[model samples]
Target: MIFSLPVQQEPKKYAPVRTLMLYLTEECNLRCTYCFVKKEPKYMSRETALRTLDWVLQRNVSGGEYKVLVNFFGGEPFLAVDLMQEVVDYGRLERPNLYKTFKFSATTNGTLANERVERVVREGQLALMVSMDGGAQANRLRPMVSGRESYSLVRKNLPRLAEWARLCTARVTFTPDNLELLKNVRDVLNVAPVGVALCPVVEADWAGHEQALEDAYAELGEWFAAEVRAGRRPPLEVTWELLRDYQQRLICKRRPQKACPLGESLMAVDSQGNVLPCHRFLHRPQQRLGTVEASELPDERWLYAHLKRAEIPDCETCVARTVCGGGCRAVALDGGYGLNEVHPYHCLLMQAHMRLVARLYAELRHDLNFWSGLAQVPTDTLNQELYQLGS
Candidate 1:
């Protein structure tokens, strides 16, 4: 089916919306081997943090978006816990007055669940996402500046980490060397019931491990389907995301939008206040969209050129276009491709994942009651349900 649009009008549904990511600091305790964040002593001061918030809130003052998300990001966000607490407190006191609903979340290394960090997270009701690549794999890939194993420290903090946040998610980044999906998934889920996102390091070379990677994902898909078939909610967040996109384009008959809403409904603010499409582009100075203190608007021309799938020749007729949404921009840029170019392996990985999604959907599609019930589940509720089930 052809999804048509008017010659000159952009749909309201496709307009840029609100989601501000704040990079609290560029300092991290651990130095991961493949980490993209440029570690430095820079931190977002209280003055700069508040300035960024005001700029975001001011943009939403006249807008119709009901909920604006403010994400706390960093080399390790917990390193700047005081700044997070201050911003959350300020947002609480100020946002309601403007009649806008603002929510707070953070992405951390899970090593600094200290007393102050716990208090801020609990009281502020912050949603936390921890970057852990499973047990020993984590120690190998991500180690402290002193070169000590961080696996034990993060593992010991899991119980308290689970309690402090309103919700928690385990973000696992797998590379060619570490393709043990089942083991990694099981290891992380066993420790904490947090939702899980299995992300491949797309920029990493997969020369000899392509088949192995595919096999691992296939095994994971089988396990996921079995868990659901047994009436248990598995905390596979990637499945939910792919399923949502598939339902929208194929089932609901809606047109596809850019998968990564970097310069659109989403954006990131670095520690030095240079606004970027997302944190992944922090090292590329040319990708800087604008700064919080600047009066001029953000430069979104790079985003606009490739915002639609039709703009890319390779994606125009691809089977996974609905869910893949032209792939990751950061990966493309990191692979030394043009802004609109997608890495070949990125496409391969997405195609493999789409197959996994298809298998899981087939398992439930025949059961009208089960399928309908799941199709109607909202994103937030689905996440909450997964959290409850995992916990």
Candidate 2:
């Protein structure tokens, strides 16, 4: 009931969104192999940053009445703190002129988490999502400057990060591949780190790891569901319960032509002020919707027009294509993935979780029969979020 999808919807206009993402800086201090932007410290100019927000106000009026959420993302968003603050300040100042409410959030690594940074978030009342791979081994993948230790610095910064988190909605990630990570973070659950959860490794090519991933999630989901059923909740990586139905509606082949909510309203601006269809595909600069200077807001760029084109081979004939919208342009382009030719391998990870949820849903269905139709689903290609989540 919390989701708006169940409401009878039109087949044509489906991609309504209440969100937007801004790349404060493509400059990241640490080198992450899985980085989608592949950017480093080049930050957004104050003018471009403010213009991006102002454009959203315009889009709301030109578009419709809907929430416009601006999530500050970065190579490391903390590096562009000033610009982040500028957007927050301007968003609050210019909000009254908008078509709807404007909210803020950020996706960052915890290294720059401090009182000053926390103050900006608190004052702006922003939501937060911080990245930290499992306890230490995973942390090794994210090395700081001069080849210095990251875990020690992260450990030292966590308490400050925890304090900032206490004042906002926050989350943490642990992508586990072995028991070493599983055992080392025993104290993580007890820590005041907003909420805790694990991320499934998605960079793998073969999709061979899915069996293990699903098995782990099945066990984890069962445990978490049981805890929640008993009124005690152990938070997992992302709140699976909240996203389950959202994914279901997306993979439902029975649906009709629809615009991607992200394609229509939620736009992502990259480090160079160039706009992208979504954040997951920033690396494919060729697919840009033109620079922020060009619009300062969302527009019907050639890329946007292309994504929804009725003749695009992959989408028009595909059943869930509209719900997924010819797949994420960037993921397809960057990974050299075959469109229509392939089943969007990103679904493997999502379906693995779905598999777990289906099992849990089955166990819980006796008291909750809403998803009885999903009982017979045989495969897991039913997820589009994991591709975007990993991309």
Candidate 3:
């Protein structure tokens, strides 16, 4: 069935697109249980990769932005190392001015952190995010093709991979089975100085597990507080983003205009050069806007129809609507719900998470000693925001 395109609404001005993610291939070495992409042996050719890069450069130039971010994404981007290298080399030579304007990054499964991939990362100064679910047991959901656990392999290579990359961050997806590990995340992942981020298992059977998820978030909050006390600032991505948004709300005394920059200022292109709303929407043909060769993007109305917080019914009255931004659109779409509607489980989780972050911010502001070296936020600004929030 062909889904009808969304009706056009009054256009709202937003930032121009400055980030583009390219899915280099759809092949993966590990069989992750919750992976959304349907794995295949397909790899992007040099021609397609270069065309995508040129498209991005043109967009940046037309949008009046000198700098742009080009993300190498995939089932495993390392599988297409040659294609990636070609793109990087081409950018440096063909568009020397725009070459220095490009910032590179990738999300990999961490098993293939070999010398070749390391050289590309170092030369391009890429920020690499490695997928690693907590301890061995928690990582059982992610196994090699031979049905063997991959935790040991990833752990062994993480430090070495961390060395060449500008920054290495761990991305964890927590399912019900591994919810308990949230408390021991640092020890389990073994990347304390590098830092870790959290994401919930999308479309999981969240029945009878709401309380467990809440408790786990609470534990994580305590963990974050401890990290602050110890003068170590781990980049807990989700939490850090939320904390900053919440603080911004208190300081500005107003809600943000948009939740995230997804459709407005960011987009993802699949290996076949089909432009998608985001990387998570890959393989979803219905959501395809156009191809990289197309001169014009899909109308903003169609691209951001479901992304606006005001479009979500529940968000109208939700207290954290400004900060939560109705959660992930991909998760909502996968759950057979409208992109405007958030999953119930995710709603509960975010509510709990926002409260935890607010409480932690309050605690940190009260004690300057806890704020000695942490760089997530400024102490003076946080103190003023806390004062405003209290008033």
Write down the TM-score of every candidate: 0.87, 0.74, 0.86
Clashes of each: 0, 4, 0
lDDT of 3 by residue, 1-391 (tens): 1111123423233344566778899999989888887889888878888887676655554356655667788888999987888877766554433432666777888898777898898888877777777778856789898998898888887887778777677777777888866777777446535656676775778788878877887888887788777767655756766677776778776765544456755688888888887777886788887888775676546875656562356666765765765566777788888866677767766676777777888888665544443344434321211111100
Give the Cα-based TM-score of candidate 1 against the true structure: 0.87
Inter-residue clash pairs, candidate 2: 15-261, 27-40, 27-41, 197-237
For candidate 2, the per-residue lDDT at 141 reads 64
Q: For model 3, what is the error of residue 79's alpha carbon versus the real structure, in angstroms, after optimal superposition?
A: 0.8
Higher-TM-score candidate among 1 and 3?
1
**Candidate 2 wrongly placed segments (more than 4 Å):** 1-17, 94-99, 155-159, 165-187, 196-201, 237-239, 242-260, 295-301, 308-327, 338-344, 366-391
Name the candidate that leads on TM-score. Answer: 1
Name the candidate that leads on lDDT: 1
**Residue 117 miss distance in model 1 (angstroms):** 0.7
* TM-score of candidate 3 against the unseen true structure: 0.86
State the displacement of the C-alpha of residue 138, model 2, in Å, after optimal TM-score superposition: 1.0
Could you tell which candidate, 2 or 3, scores higher by lDDT?
A: 3
Task: Give the per-residue lDDT of model 2 (tens digit) for 46-112.
Answer: 8778777655554445455556677788778878887777777777763333345667777777778
Task: Report the error of model 2 at residue 218, Å.
Answer: 2.8
